[model samples]
Target: MTSTRRRGLIDIEIDAQKEKVRKIKEDNRIFDTLETDKTTLDNEKKKWFFTRWFSPTSIDDLEKRIARKEQKIKEGLERTSIDKIHELEERIRILELAKTNRCENVVWMDVPEILDKKIQDDYLEKFRKLPQKIDEQVQSVNITMFGGVGVGKSSFLNTVVTALINNPQRIYRDYKTAPSTTGISKTKAFIPEEIRKKRGQSYREHPTFKDVMHCIVFVIPATTNLYDRDDEALNKIRNLQQRINGPRDVKQVAIVTNIDRIGVPNVDMESVFKYPNVKEFCEDVSKVLEIEIQSVYPIANYHEEQKPTAAKNALALMALWDMFKCGERHIKKKLEIGLNDDQ
Candidate 1:
């Protein structure tokens, strides 16, 4: 071979040897780094396992601790569930009792006979003389007329006043509007003639009965069920009863108005009166008011009276008058009792 070719061959062989050596060194360095990282990871894992699984005094102790915690959680849940169940049961009991009371039916004259005969005789005498006693006086009663809006409450009041002032000879005054924004007006009117002719001059206009409302007439709309506004109506009635001055003022009556709108398939007023809702409403009102409802009168008011054959509206007015008269008699009896007690 020529000298130049031999020299080039020698240089290529040396370069190839040097490249192989460099690649071997690089590979060794990468393996060393990987080994170190693997060792570190293994050590950390072992340490964590030792601390978590082996650090306890014994396996049995660890097991006991776990079981106790589980038991505590279970017991807590059970206690909470039991407490909730008890609360629910108590609530249900109250509701059931209220329901039972609401379903009960009683007659007005069947009120418990607890009075002495002398007291009864005195009451009867006063009751008989009530008309003469109240003659020529303005007797005012404070009434809390309750029902939903559009329940013929205003219509009932108008009917009552109209009935009171039906005679052309008497001058009747319209009551001032109630201050409610909902256009519900509860007013106190002086049925001057009824008061004057029925009660005596000594009985003056008194404030809304401080004790019991002399009369409570629930004016229900005929078209709806008694459960209509049941919760709301019951709440208001309860509140009013609470506001009554004393037990004596707790006179109550139920007037189911709007029979004309009821529009039965084939029923008369007498048949309609047998409706479960009507009976239920009457009973509920009496229970809530804490008084025996003096009566339940069904009333229907259309433009023309002939449309409702039952004279329901007129009868309702008569019911109101009867309630007022009964309440007045009660008041006089109470007053007499007070006088006797004072003596």
Candidate 2:
């Protein structure tokens, strides 16, 4: 489409999207108010609020209204449209072209925002740490995988490890091994703490893992309604987080895995962007999870990559980049410095 035509389309889409989002926000507020009122009702019924006398007619009317209102709100959330998000995405992509014109203003970062140069530099010496390689010194980040069970958490983590290691076979073999479950399980994934004891000539040392632990990876499956998260949604993820009792401010990213199974008929690892809904899925998931849109990613893991494909590697790497950006944003907040677009 011509730039002029695209501009007109974007403006219209933006207005539509804005109105839809406004309604979603209003619905959420209404639900919150209803929930609060219901809690108060419960307390009164239990006589915990020093109310021994209660009117049955008034109680029945209030309970009925609250139940009806709650259902309405639930339906609204499930039906929240992503048309606005897609429109905004198109707008942003078009605007970004201005910055990347002739590649003069394009911005990029080589290292994860949360990593120190000295620590990431260990990748040069440590090569890659193994499940039992307690003697290798390396930087580690704790990734708490959150999603409904079997959302490809273990598969994605294994993909990342394979990409970064000098010996992919070793990582693959370890992933097959039962103990490698330590890297990623239904509950949590981590760089095992079985200390790296030596280096080429000097003893290996791990200095960064302890300080920046608990990076959160929120996973959304392609099989579910991306926004209509009635029983299955970010609230469940948040509850899990509270139960784990990790730091309230741990850096977080959302990974929409199993992209190969999204509504598209020709779903594959390489054709992510061709499916426009995939982009919409990422943005909607981000909003529901309450994180930056840029922090949301849709990726295919190594489930089908017997030897690891380039497409899978690239997808996994970008996912890692965003996770680091989440960590970086937390760091920026610490220093009281604002974040940039590249992050």
Candidate 3:
């Protein structure tokens, strides 16, 4: 099975287990309360008082309730159904198979030749024209990149703008990146200061298609261990996704940066997908972000490179192409749904 599909199945299982645990804990709390009540009734019955003899019926009723709760807990404990057993067997088989076989490439693409200007131009043109072709209310596609402090969100944005403009000499205002000393993000708002200044209005106040972000791109480091990720930061990411994208029904994608750092098959950018580590990283990010595995794009940014290459440009443009498409779809769908609601 493909890493993407396997990751999706694993995510579903994780969510199901969490829900089951929650339900069991809730039931346990109720069971504990019933047990406490039964104990109180038993103690009352043990007292050598007139009330003890009168409350025999209450004690019996409490015992009956406790027995029922105990039975329910027993049933809940035996939750290993046939489907779960089969899923466990399948997971074991996949793991055993992976021990000998290499991971298959999840994403396939033809690397644009360095001399193929026409194809490169087409990519840039398609991305540039998407906003204009979208709904009239959306004059520009606003894409928000958010994630952990120094996961290369700013660098990825710089790479996209650089590739889109196809200019290295042009001094465009860049997003403030993390400093080497303390890896802190200065991007406090969704829209950067430059764009906000140009628009002279805040997206929060406007809440319009033109002002709001249409697509959310979550950036993650290729080396990040999601298991060890900070709980606070992860919660913030989930809340940010829910508050912005979930409510607006905006499309979301994830970018795994620093692909070069993860040992990409002899340091070749073209072999990114062929690298098992890269696919594994993408799968991890997809599961954590609750996005489709296909929506996770892994790429190396032009962090230290002076000029862009065809390979780098192709990766950047591919991600941009998806982002533009996502933004356009969001605009169209939002407008259609709004119209329907009004009618």
Candidate 4:
């Protein structure tokens, strides 16, 4: 009976050990599954963060795309602005009209001779059609002459008219001095002899005597005190203003004659405005001068006998001529406006 009891106890112990081993195996399997799941969740979270925060394209590329879009939008707005279109159209029209009505007042020439064939041809082509041109557009000029008495204002006028008769190349290169007692003369020459004839024989009746005179020339004297307070110079300016038919009918040019006498003491041409009360006087003069005066062109005004072959002198003369031509064009434009108004 003792032997049977001992065998039963050993069997029970063996069963208990088997049960413990099975439980240990199950716990290890559960731990492995949990570890695998945690690893998968961590990998997914990392992928989401990379996609949300980081861009594949560079920063420079992104800025360029934005800028291109802005430019396109600006261009579209500009294209749709009606006011801009109207302004551009108006400017185009004005330019076209100006081109169509351009005047050939001062003709260019290779030689300074009235008889030059080319110059004559140009003159005839323009002059013969003067009436038609004037009707289409009347040109206005303002002329100013500065010089001491005897700088040859009248003589210059004769030369200018002669040049006009044939060609502008015939412009007089020589001028004589006038007496001290007599002041330099300023006049406005107009086209169409009929107008001059009707106005009468006075200097005031010169075609430019009317407020609507077309051309202006300024004759500067050789050694005159242009800034003087005396009545002589002032009177000429006053007379010039009175001749313009209307305020808008004037154009201006400054002719400085007798450059030889320019640098004398108390007679500096450049410092003319520095004289006593000269600024006020000139402003007043401008008010009556009928045109806005821009600058002064120095002329040698040498006599035919006294002329020298100095290259510098010749260059100076050419420069003056060019300057006058530029001013002439400006005056012509103003005249065109007046003519358009009349039409």
Q: Pick the winner on TM-score between candidates 2 and 4.
A: 2
Q: Which runs of model 4 end up more than 4 angstroms from their true locations?
A: 1-149, 154-212, 242-246, 263-294, 304-343
Each prediction's TM-score versus the true structure: 0.40, 0.44, 0.55, 0.34
lDDT of 4 at 191: 30
lDDT of 2: 0.54
Quote the positional error of residue 42 for candidate 3 in Å.
99
Task: Give candidates' CA RMSD values in order.
Answer: 33.5, 22.9, 22.0, 37.3
Scored by TM-score, the top model is: 3
Q: Least lDDT summed over 10 consecutive residues: which range in candidate 3?
A: 178-187
Please write out the lDDT profile of model 4 over residues 115-141, one tens digit for every residue: 223433454344344332222233322
Encode model 1's per-residue lDDT on 92-210: one tens digit a residue. 44433333332223333322222223333343343334442332232434454566566766666655444333433322233243223212235433322344465555354553323
Select the stronger candidate by TM-score from 2 and 3.
Answer: 3
lDDT over C-alpha atoms for residue 319 of model 3: 84
lDDT of 3 by residue, 189-221 (tens): 243334445654432544545666678887777
TM-score of 1: 0.40
